[model samples]
Target chain A: MAELTDTAQQRATGLLRDYGAAVRAKRIRAAMYFVALVICVLAASWSGEVDLRKFVEGLPRFGSYFRDITPTLRPATLGSDIAEWYWNFPVWLELLLETLLVAYVGTLAGATLGFFLCFFTSANISGNRTVSFVVKRALEFCRTVPDIVFALLFVFAIGLGPVPGVLAIAIHTAGALGKQFAEVIENIDLKPVEGLRSTGANWVDQIQFAVLPQVTSNFASYVLLRFEINVRGATVMGFVGAGGIGKELLGSIRQFYYSDVSAILLMIIATVVVIDLLTERLRHRLLGTAKV
Target chain B: MKPRIAEPCDIDRLRTAYPSAFAPGYARRAAALAGISAVVGLFIFGVVWLGFSPSALVQGISKLGVILKLMFPPTAGQHMLVYLQALAQTLSIALLGTMLAALVAFPLSFLAARNVVGRWLLRFLTKRVFDAIRGIDTLVWALIFINVVGLGPFAGILAVAMSDVGAFGKLFSEAIETASPKPVEGVLSTGASKIQEVRFAIVPQVLPLLLSQVLYYFESNIRSATVIGIVGAGGIGLYLSNEIGQQSWDHVSFIILMILITVAIIDAVSGRLRRSIIGAQARS
Candidate 1:
């Protein structure tokens, strides 16, 4: 090995020191992040009033509530009958069905409205810039307000029932789906639209012949997803006296009908799971067709 | 053969040969028309049943007018600080919930991840557990926690955390599973322990994604926390609902405006934050 000159050795030492400094800087940065996190956590705990001592003491109570909600028939009454476990299944089932119908109808109506508006709103597809702006603003307004809030107003306007729930869900869906649908439309292959336009097709004809074919599957998928959300929203809307399983749920909670609350919750959960499975399968089928 | 413009007869012959090029099928048209009509029919059915009569609508509009007129002077009223405190509490609930859930989910995701859990049975069971947790709504959890915690933001925080834990379990596990194994193998080749490998390889890969997701959820949880508050868990929602219940439309309007502004601001900030963080990660 060649002998290192004095200057070369000095340079090497300087480079090593610089590298160490860089490493130290990184460590300091990481430490600062940790410190910030801790500070925020402390602040959050203070503001949230989350007393750990109380939480530890209350933990058992939490478990006991769950335990209490669990249905326990007397040993003498024990049997294989499902009805014994879910005494209010028939009434709950009807309310759940109504909730489903609310979602289905709301989604259908919203999707139709959204499908029209999205084409106009898409930046790429310009019929009139002014019209698109107004539609976009309207959709933004619709979506910005939470669905439950709308349900509350509708309850005031139309009186209590699933009708308010439907109206609320539909308006909210129109806003949300319109934005997504417009994005999908904007991202589509514009060549097809251009081709239709070159064939002397009008705006409607162009969208019908070109854009619709490409976007329909995606539109359907979004609608299906919205329907799922609307189902949940419908349930919540009922809490506001808009009508559905939520009304009974609220009543049960208020009356401390612990077993009924658990039973109703279970039914809702089961319905959601089944819908999730169905939608997953349906989405796959639609996407598979889209590829072809 | 001389080139010539196609006559109408020639065009008709071509159209007959390639019908799809010209006319949509009668069946398809009919199906579309039928579908639209059915949707309209159902909407009308619901509308009619809901008593959306023209006169009823006019009457309702007049009633709404009265509320609107009252709501015009959007003042914070006497309890501005109370409203502000409630808003702060809501933000804290969302922040703490998101952070706590992220902390809990980070470890449990390994159990749920198909790539990490060697046994199919363990992974399947873990996923189902996650699913069950997620199947329960945040409001439902809030109600449960309300009875246990005896109201206030503590219950709201727990409710948000519980729901997010379920969501983050699925999301984090998916993130873990999608990570390229090459870096992990490289770490293993260096005679590193399992924990070291995870730290050197997996953590580096997924931490950015985890952070980004937590940030995104923080924004959404703010809104969700408000909803939970409506159930008396505690927040601006409780305040807003009370105002509405008491027919204090001005305060309700003010609170609503605050919510809208807060949400919009958070959305914009999160977008920027994500872009910067992801960009930094990409460069590194």
Candidate 2:
């Protein structure tokens, strides 16, 4: 009985020793992370010249604005003429359509460009390593810059219009979709392509017979997904004078037209809902997972 | 019998058995597609001719080079304090927004998950809600909230929260869907309640992934928050835009540098945190 008790105690000690080591490692990691975060915050604060006093001063203004919004949302003027002016159906509908068109055109253009690049960038599909590397790096650079910055640059280049917005969205989408497409291509079953190659098919023929078929559905799904994203992006591109519903929204806000703002929000929400439903159905159908 | 001279009937049977080798159908389809491509090519040429000038592109590139020259040797001068404050505000907005979205999404994601919800209609509705929200960019949400709340960090926070709710919900649901079912089943077999099954089994399985995603979003939100600020939701983006509007290209460069450094640091830290969490899970 004494020997058994000693054995049990020794085993418990061993377990505790292992647990202690894990705990210590965890603590050290946590401390290192904390230190890193602090260093980053300090560096940013120093570089940006952030003042604590100004932040404190600004806090009250924020409070006042929040307070104003609550009373402004009250429905006391529901039946008033002002409400009618704010919620004009034709204006809202026109803006919504413009936004949708920008998103649609952008997605189509982006997907087309991206699909071409995907083959060149994909190591599994590209005939040469050097071409794949260059294409992949180009895509990475394209995607690294935020879409809004791209919009700003395009607006500067093309002059202000929905054209700039469309172009910006297209460029960003191409980068993002290209990367996703390449990944999809990389993960595809290579047997089919190999078999085509064995039959003396050239690169283009092999891709057409094997690679394209496997990824077509996925590509379609991503395009639809990008369209949905572009819709939202196109809406706000107007703030930079890139024309859309966002321009109207911005104008309304500047004029303090609260009722108009509410109307626009409702319109946007409704449009988004419709698009969401359509895409979901399309995805399910394309993926062949639709339930009987 | 086979050594006898091949008859015309036997040759016909062989040709019919392998139609692909002898068929004209594939060639005809390829020719039709080529015709369609020609039409598309003409349409593209028409549009390009209508919309743009090649000389204008050359002029624009030269102008871009001049603008880029003005941006070099970034100056952090008199307005440094203002820029810093705005940067801090952006960080706070990102942090608050990410936290709010993560907290809200953690519960809603379960409802969106097909495995967790079990009811197809309910799950479908929740999922669609996420998609609709996500379909709209964070900038749009910022614009909406700027209208609602009146141009400040508060609006920025709300926008980030709203957009992240959609994104986090989708991501979290995907993670939940991909989690190991064995643990959930084990809990269920032990007479655990549905909620308990999720709590004891599903949550643990997906928590690390969910945390990592949330952290990544936080880093992404920092960049997004800056962009929204350009539209007057209050952040360094507003300052950056202002500087650009004034053609203070030096200051614009300075702000860009600040953003780059901040983003890089956040990315590194978050990446480390993700690795550590994954490691812990592996050890367990």
State each model's CA lDDT, in order: 0.84, 0.79
Please, what are the lDDT tens digits per residue for candidate 1 over residues A146-251? Answer: 8887777777767788877877888989999999999999999999999989989999999999998889999888888887777767776788887778888888
DockQ of each: 0.50, 0.19
Residue-by-residue lDDT tens digits, candidate 2, A191-259 = 999999999999999999999988888888888887876777777888888767888877876776656
Q: What is the Å distance of residue B88 in model 1 from its true position?
A: 0.9
Report clash pairs, candidate 1: none
Residue-level lDDT of model 2, residues B1-284, one tens digit each, is 46686676777887888888678797788987996688467546533533445675576567668878998999978988888888888887787778779999999999988788889999999988887677567876776566555667777877898899999999999999999889988999999998899999999899888888999899889879888888777788888778777878899888887887787787897899889888878888
Error of 2 at A37 (Å): 7.1
- Docking level for model 2: incorrect
What local lDDT does model 2 show for residue B149?
57
- Standalone chain B TM-score for every prediction: 0.86, 0.84
Q: Write the per-residue lDDT of candidate 1 for residues B78-151, one digit (tens) a residue.
A: 98999989998988899999988998989999888776678998888888878877877788788888888888
Candidate 2 at B274: error in angstroms?
Answer: 2.9
Candidate 1 regions exceeding 4 Å error are A3-23, A73-81, B1-62
